[model samples]
Target: MSADLWKPSAEIKTLQQRAAILRTIREFFCDRDVMEVETPSLSAASVTDVHLASFNTTFVGPGHAGGLPLYLQTSPEFAMKRLLAAGSGAIFQLCKAFRNEEAGKHHNPEFTMLEWYRPGFNEFTLMDEVDELMQLILAVQPAERLTYQQAFQQALGIDPLTASLESLQQLAIQQGFADIAEYETHRDTLLQLLFCMKVEPKIGQNKPCFVYHFPASQAALASICEHDQRVAGRFELYYQNMELANGFNELTNAKEQAKRFNEDNAHRKANNLKEVPMDTRLIAALEHGLGQCAGVALGIDRLVMLATRKETIKEVIAFDVGRA
Candidate 1:
């Protein structure tokens, strides 16, 4: 019960800026012939990624029937892909997404997401589109592009794709990062630490930067690099060390997707978390055939924050769930 916790003037200005940015975004896509689309907020299954914790709830049907398990989507990715498979060309959506265990200056349990897909486009083509859209929305020049390896090399003097786990851990310690031993077994955990502690702070100093071609193991939902075989077709946009978007070439192989999903579930089980059911409908949609496409999900709040130079996520949001 803090009396000074609220600020009406600051919140109103932030909301105004946020609305202007959203309007600009819609106008940008409209001018580019990207149709705005909407999808379900609740699903029978949630994303299987072990790193993301989905918010689960129970829904009661007609006649006061027993509740059925449901989950608020972490992103509109699966449903949007289903639409892509069914021939929705060049679509975009701005919607609210939920995650269970995220709350910080940059994170909230409920936040806005701007997701888009480009049919018949590869990673590079869609990345250019993202750049143009960002410029249009922010009324600023386009950002720079840096490969994942290049960013790591510039920050830590090591090739992330080739560095051993011990090397990464040692570097973390040398950089005065505490809890280095805590991430020795998880390669991604160590990479995340280094990226956040050393690399990210140096990115997008002048303009946004697209960090592309991630290691295959950290692909998440992106396709693997055919040329290198050890890297994936993934990229994340950063502005002033803040993550703004994640994009990738769509992985259309249903079988490979299933394998990856299973691997994710195995990791979940090992971590003593509930194994999320795979989206069979998505798999079916993939089996029916989806064209070569690339998609991206950007944090709308963070974009607004960057545009307005806001420090905390709550400043950009109107009535954050915690306050609600």
Candidate 2:
């Protein structure tokens, strides 16, 4: 081991600034009357989202002669929604979330997340609140809003929602992306690849941009738009080409939620990934009436990185995954 193995990844000064930013965030939520809460970092089930990989461990205690498996939460979303169902109005949490096999300039295996829920709020209203918070923290001006279709049109001259699969494949080939022929049957995968590679780097260059009305197929937990059946009420906030947060006009239909979970598992199986146990309690909570609400999850370390003008995640965190 190196002699500096015991040292923290970030400087003491940067850590101090990080503390102040966290305090400011808490104060901001408190002033808005949003109650701060905590939830477990470990759970019996993990999120079925194929994009996220979770860390798991064995628990050999309590009611079992054999070991029981537990997974570290990728986000505090499920438990928080359960609290919302139990009449916890307008709550927020600053907690650690873990994801396996993730480490890069902007990622770590474990990171702080700021997630919140607002009762009786839609996706647009939630975007306004997120904009206000970003202005307060990063000292940015008012954000620019665009629909997902508009973003794609502006950046790539293609309408993602209406484009044919063959057209998208042609675009991908023209863009010189390798190995895209394998994903011809996956329309969403093609759209996502083009968006991440081309559109994401172009938007939010001047100010925060809120991209809303995602495709119905990509809506994980958001309700489909009543006027536009092709899209859902999901939005993402991006700043300086970095994705800052994702929010949704919460979906409260239990049957629909269960169906989505199973679909996710099926997608996982098709992709040769492990099938995750779905959160039955969350489904039960939805069945018990969660009512109208909007929720968002933001990455705190990334926010701090933007605020502090740091290039890497390690500069803002005291101990990143490698150091830990």
Candidate 3:
């Protein structure tokens, strides 16, 4: 490697901006009486979300996890939920998170995440908080709240819920999208393709936007909407063609959660990916009776990119994996 590779990727002023942003974030939470917290970056039980990959390592020592594999924390959700189960109300954390297969203009193998929980809040309430935070940070206009169905309908001229697989596939082909045949059989994958290629780029072009009521299949850990039955209680915050946060109305049913984990592992098996270790502690927490709560995990680096008006995340972060 050249000597220049040792140089920090971010300029001094950008580093200043990052520091200031951190301070502002802490102040934001403090003002709301949300206690700041810290949790482990590694866990014996990793996440089982099929879409997320966790970096694993083996521990070797006496009186400890001898020869046992531990996974880097993908998010602080499980631990935070465990705290909520222990009666810790309204907590937030700004910490390092890891994923195995991620590297791009907006992704890093290791990244910063700002995760928080609000007890007694529903999905809509959390979405409103996210919008308000954007207003506080970016001074942006009031966010446009769009349902997943509405976004798909106006952006792609199809109703996502009622559209058949062939219709979605044909739309993809018509949009000059190539190699979508592999995704044709998967409904969620097709929806993702259309949303990413057609809808997402158009959202938050001029202001922050909140897209909610995701399809049940792609909800991950969110609960299914009681009224709609088909939509999950999930919302994503976006600005300037970038996704900044993912929020969910916490699902407290232990059995349903375990079922989802098993399904996720099965999907991973079908895809030939490693099946992640299930977080039994989190499941136990749910069994212990977690109260109604909604939480969100925001990408701090991406937020910094937006706050600093940087074109790419590399400009705001001190180092990308390539440079590190």
Candidate 4:
């Protein structure tokens, strides 16, 4: 046996802090009438977002002629939406989400996620709620709201919507990004690189920040801005230069949502990644009317790291992946 194999990664004090934090989170939602919920961790299908990788396993039982593939849910968004479609109002779930190849300082193959949806709330109103939630949890000041356009312009001196591909590549090179050439001519990829290398480092330096109005191409589950079709109604919260939460004015149209899922799988195939099966049930829920709402997913482990003043997520989690 390896030495110290039985010891947990987190100290008793850190674990106590975690317990207290979870308690406060529950109280916060309870005070607001948000019902706590639970959903299955395994699913017949998983998220097809190119940025995420889902874990898969074979399910063999009496119901199957052979083993059937099941995916570990990357987030509870789909199931929670189904609940909303079934008329469950304002619900929150504090549960585990699993992803492949995702263990690090702020990530684990299996990690806690706190997700909620507020019916009749748009992204802006939900942002205010997020501000309140952050203050309640982290003792943080009111978060400043900034647009994607403004963040890009202020940090990198380029308008993200209108910046030329050549300019993006040139600026990335100037910032000492050696991999700029590898990104080639994909505008979105170059924009992402620029944002990561340049703008992201300067965000949420002192107080919290909410960056919204993302480019339409980056709209994962968010609705497009009706007035400005170039942008999506999504927001991401950052704290002390670390990303903390992502919220969206959710897309409600079934046809559009289906198209996006297919597009995501197509993109995955084009990049030589495995294409995930489409989540037909979620689409059915959308077709049945998911309603207008805003939802967000926050990384609970990362929040615990901040609340406990720990340097890495491993310090706050009960067990690290290796130990688990």
Candidate 5:
């Protein structure tokens, strides 16, 4: 590629606006007494989510010992949670994260993530805090809160939790996403397609929206709702129909967490993908006890996009994958 291709346009003032917004985020957190923390970007284990591919590399040890395999973290979640288990108080981190096989207008192999955790908080409490944080960051009034089911009902006239896989696929086809039929056997995949194609574009139409109470099957790391076994204590934030963050009332049960991780690996095996090692250390931390807490991971790039009203992530990022 030409060197000129890597340079950003001089008129990209949105980049400067993004930087200012990020500074405001840190200021907000610091004022709230949340300590900024740093964690390793490379780890012995990566997230088990089959859909998120992780980039792997090797590290040399002292005395020229054999290289040890390491994976770039998809998020700072595991290590941060370990710190929480070790009794760290309200903390936040802003860092670059990596994910393999992602490149697009809204995606890059390397991207920024802003993650935070609050002790003694549930999903609802954290949702309120996120709403307030958005107001502060965007310098706007309070945002709206809508449950996941309500968002789906408003957009597609169907319930996400109770809808069958076939019904979701049909809805996708009817809505002009004919490719969704290929994932008929995977309910989660079909639901995601429906949401992305039909539902997301309608969310947060007037302001930021907090969509909570996700289906239990799609809870990547959240705890299942005790009152409703079919749903999980998870939520996602959206603005102008763009997803910005995902939060959860963390599941502190080690056994259940292990089960979920193993199931993810099993799915990987079934799909002939390489099996990733489980983070036994994280499970141990959970067993040792993590205080009642809620955590969230927000896409900094998406936030920058919204703050600048940029159409593509490349416009806001310093350098995207195609240039790098």
Candidate 6:
């Protein structure tokens, strides 16, 4: 073993700055009267999002004889939503989130997440709050808003909402992604690859940018826009070409939420990945009634990287997954 293995991944000074920024985040929410709350890092169910992977462990001691399986939450979104359904007004959580197969310049398997939910707030209103926090933390100007369609049109000269799968495949090939032919049926996958490779690094370089009105098919947990059926009321905040936050005008309908979860499982099966158990408790909470609300999950380590002008997440985190 190397002697340097005992050293922290981040410098002492950087950790200090990271702590100060966390304190600032608390103050920001406190000023807005958002109550800070906590949730368990482990749960019986995990997100069914195909793009994300969860870490699992077995609990040997339980009320029963058999070992119980549980997953380390990728985010506190589900538990927090349960709180919202129980009538917790304007709550936020600064917690540790875990994901498998994620470790890079921008990603760590275990990282800090700042997530909050605001009842009676739409995607637009919640975006303004996110912008305010970004401005205060990164000292950036007010974010410029752009629809998903506009972003694609401006970056690749194609309308993402109307483009056919065949056309997107051809475009991806032209853009040197010839392997995209293997997943020709996955329209969202092609769009995401194009956006990350071609669009993301270009925007949010000059100022923070708010990309909203994503295609309804890619809405994740957000609600479909009332006026535009083709799009959803979801938004993401990006700064210096780094995605800082993802927010949504939350979906409160139990049936729709269940439908999405089933659809996700179907996709996972088609892709030959393990089908995760859906959060029936969350659905029950929705059935009991979760009113209009908006929620966001922001990456704390990434924010610290931007604030300190660091190149990688390791420079901001006290000990990244490698050191841990």
Ranking by TM-score: 6, 2, 4, 3, 1, 5
Per-residue lDDT of 1-324 in model 5, one digit per residue for the tens?
586985873236877788788899999899989989999999999999988999999989795378888999999999999999998899999999999999887888899999999999999998888888787776655778888888899988999888887787788788887764745578888888787777888878788888889999889699999899988999998888678899999999999999999999998898889999998889999999998899999998888777677888888888777777
Please write out the lDDT profile of model 4 over residues 15-115, one tens digit for every residue: 99999999999999999999999999999989989889999998899887698899999999999999999999999999999989887877889999999
- TM-scores, each model vs. reference: 0.94, 0.98, 0.97, 0.97, 0.94, 0.99
Supply candidate 4's per-residue lDDT for 106. Answer: 78
Which 10 consecutive residues of model 5 have the lowest summed lDDT? 6-15
Error of 6 at 102 (Å): 0.7
**What digit string (tens of lDDT, one per residue) describes model 1 on residues 234-267?**
9999887789999999899999888899999998
Q: For model 2, where is the 10-residue window of minimal lDDT?
A: 176-185
Write down the lDDT that model 1 would get.
0.88
Distance (Å) between predicted and true CA of 9, model 2?
Answer: 1.0
Cα deviation at 115, candidate 4, in Å, is 0.2
Candidate 3 structure quality by residue, lDDT tens digits, 48-130: 88778889888888866458778899999999999999999999999999998898888889899999999999999998888
- Model 4 regions more than 4 Å off: none
lDDT, residue 256, candidate 2: 95
Q: With candidate 5 superimposed using the best TM-score fit, by how many Å does residue 93's alpha carbon deviate from the native?
A: 0.3
| Per-residue error (Å), model 5, residue 150 | 1.5
List model 2 lDDT by residue over 61-149, tens digit each: 78965988999999999999999999999999999999998999989999999999999999999999999999999999999999999
**Which stretches in model 6 have alpha-carbon errors above 4 Å?**
none
Q: Which of the two candidates, 1 or 6, achieves a greater lDDT against the reference? A: 6
